[model samples]
Target: MTCSPDDFRAAMRRFPSGVAIVAAGSAPHRAGMTATAICSLSADPPQVLACLNRLSSTCRAVEDARFFSINLLATSQLALARIFAGLEGGVSADQKFTAGVWRLGVTGAPILEDAVLTFECALVTAHPASTHNIVIGEVRHITGEVAEDALIYRSGVFGRWTGLAVTQPHLS
Candidate 1:
């Protein structure tokens, strides 16, 4: 038997994931949405994958622009995240930029000036997967250093990764 949607969501909630805002386009026409479905797809070619809902305006912008930036949020950016997520009702597409400092990336996508990390990428391909588009992008630019105070989402709650134990295991 297949798991129900609610069951699937419940299971996925147990997996903690980093929070980020995926943005595209230039000023006056930019689009952005809070996302947790971004990850590095490859290192050699420097690629990343971000899943966007097929119906989101940002998804269309990314498709039309063929470029986007993934801005990883810090714990301090919870309000920004909520704004992009449309949780701050009545905030229009253009108004969301007013909430954060933004700059144009090499790919022309809007980058968060104070993001924990930002990845500017050129669209490689987008595959339609059920209700979302699996967007693949080739890294064109990167900014920010790795920091411990990154934002995370799990179990329907937004939180931060507390520095537990930093360790590197040797592979023999």
Candidate 2:
């Protein structure tokens, strides 16, 4: 038997992904949102893909900002992650970053200073992907923790650092 739509979604959610809040903006119009669907689409050209809802405010910001940043949240950044995730509803794009610890990337997108990693990128391509659009970005700048662990989402909750264990054998 084929999996129902809900079953497919449930199964997909079981696979944990590194949490990241992708930011894009131009000063007062900046916007960001938490995303767990970003992934490497190509290694040769240093490209990655992010999926964002077409109607999301952040999605609109990305369209006009010319650049985007992926801030890989550390395990300790759960609060920041939640804030950007829109779990508490939307806030003015500028206001959202006011309380968070962030610094500007080369592309001018806000990069969380405490993030495990951050990638500043320029849009390369975009295509329709189900209810969202798959944005492919060309990595332009890279910074942040080379050794820090990443926060993860699993079973609709966050509290894991799988990257820490995988990267540091000493911790394993």
Candidate 3:
């Protein structure tokens, strides 16, 4: 039997994911959206993948410009994430940058200055599946800080890394 959308979504939500923003284009035509489907693909050529909804303006911009940036959010940036996700009504397409400091990357995509990590990539390819496009890109530039904590999402709730870890016992 085919899985129902609600069931699929519920199951997927159990897996905690780091929050990020996929942004494209420059001022006046810039578009961005909160995303969680980003991951490293390869290190040889420094590649990564970010999935964007096909109908999102950011996705269309990336397609046309052939580039994009994945800005990984820190735990303190939940408000920014919400704003970029369009959850905050009345914020227009171009005004999203007003919520945070942004700069143009080497590929001309908007990059969040305060992101825990930023990956500026040149679009390599995109594969369409259902309502989203799996956009693959080759990393051209990156900047990050290791001390920053990350924002996480799971089961419709937002959380953060508390920097807690258990010490491992010695093993032979």
lDDT for each of the candidates?
0.93, 0.84, 0.90
User: How many residue pairs clash in all the candidates, one count each?
Assistant: 0, 0, 0
TM-score (C-alpha, index-matched) for candidate 3: 0.93
Q: Could you tell me every candidate's TM-score relative to the true structure?
A: 0.94, 0.88, 0.93
Instruction: Work out how many backbone clashes candidate 1 has.
Output: 0
Instruction: Give the CA lDDT, 0 to 100, for residue 49 in model 1.
Output: 99
lDDT of 3: 0.90
- Which 10 consecutive positions of candidate 2 have the poorest summed lDDT? 163-172
How far residue 82's Cα lies from its native spot in candidate 1, in Å, is: 0.5
Cand. 2 Cα-lDDT: 0.84
Which candidate wins on lDDT? 1
lDDT of 3 by residue, 33-122 (tens): 999898999999999998889999999989988889999999889999999988999996879989989999877889998899999999
Runs with alpha carbons beyond 4 Å of true place in candidate 2: 89-92, 162-172
Winner on TM-score between 2 and 3 is 3
Task: Sort the predicted structures by TM-score, highest score first.
Answer: 1, 3, 2
For residue 116, give model 3's deviation from the true position in Å: 0.4
Candidate 1 backbone collisions, by pair: none
Candidate 3 vs. truth: CA RMSD?
A: 2.0
